[model samples]
Target: MRLLPWTGAGGKPCYLSTDDPHSPLSRLADDIEALHLADAAGVLEGARAVLDDPGAGEHAVRFALARAVESLGDTLRVAVSRGECA
Candidate 1:
């Protein structure tokens, strides 16, 4: 939902920004897309075939994906902080 006047302190899994670069969601999406693009072709092709279950298999798969994306965001944050990223 696009906010007409949204006002909520962005909770910490993401960094909030008045600018989009500081938005964790934006950063996460970009990182995931990049990781998926930069892979050695079809590495993740079987992710879709995994069945949903209470076992750690599903959680592991999901957490790994999310962690990879978050790592990218973290890298970007560090890069920007070091004045190395645009």
Candidate 2:
């Protein structure tokens, strides 16, 4: 059982049961995980910029925080899916 990067309906975690790593669904999951990781990298950079700005407003900080939290979740999921985390 492999945990997919995205959730199912009602925010439940989705899993993939397959032996073929190159299967269509497996490939799709791999592609989506890659996208999530890439997006997380960009989000981390933006969040750092926002935090480093002394003049950044509350709204800007909050928005950056929200995006950072979301990206963190995605990145964690990817890690778990790849067996990088225990």
Candidate 3:
């Protein structure tokens, strides 16, 4: 069973049960995962910039933090789906 990157209704984890990793759904999941990782990289950079800026306001920091948290969740989900977690 391969855990998909996206959740189902009610925020439940979705899984793919297939021997063919190249199947349509599997490919879609792979693509989405790649996107999530790419977005995470950008979010990390932006968050760092916000944190390093002394002139940044609370709103700016909070926004960056929210995005970072969201990206972190996505990245963690991808890791778990890929069996990278211990």
Top candidate when judged by TM-score against the true structure = 3
Question: Candidate 1, which segments miss by more than 4 Å at Cα?
Answer: 1-56
Q: Please report, in order, the local distance difference test score of every candidate based on alpha carbons.
A: 0.47, 0.94, 0.96
Please provide, for model 3 over 1-86, each residue's C-alpha lDDT reduced to its tens digit, 9 standing for 90 to 100. 99999999999999999999999999999999999999999999999999999999999999999999999999999999988983
User: Arrange candidates by lDDT, highest first: which order?
Assistant: 3, 2, 1
Q: Which 10 successive residues of model 3 have the least lDDT summed? A: 77-86
- Which is better, 1 or 3, measured by TM-score? 3
Cα lDDT of model 1 overall?
0.47
TM-score of each: 0.34, 0.95, 0.97
**Model 2: clashing residue pairs?**
none
Show the colliding residue pairs in model 3: none
lDDT of 2 by residue, 1-86 (tens): 99998899999999999999999999999999999999998999999999999999999999999999999999999999889986
Candidate 1 lDDT over 1-86, as tens digits, reads 11211124673333334456547665665565455445513333334333343454857787656655655555555445435676
Error of 3 at 86 (Å): 4.5
- Once fitted onto the true fold, the runs of candidate 3 whose alpha carbons sit more than 4 angstroms away are none
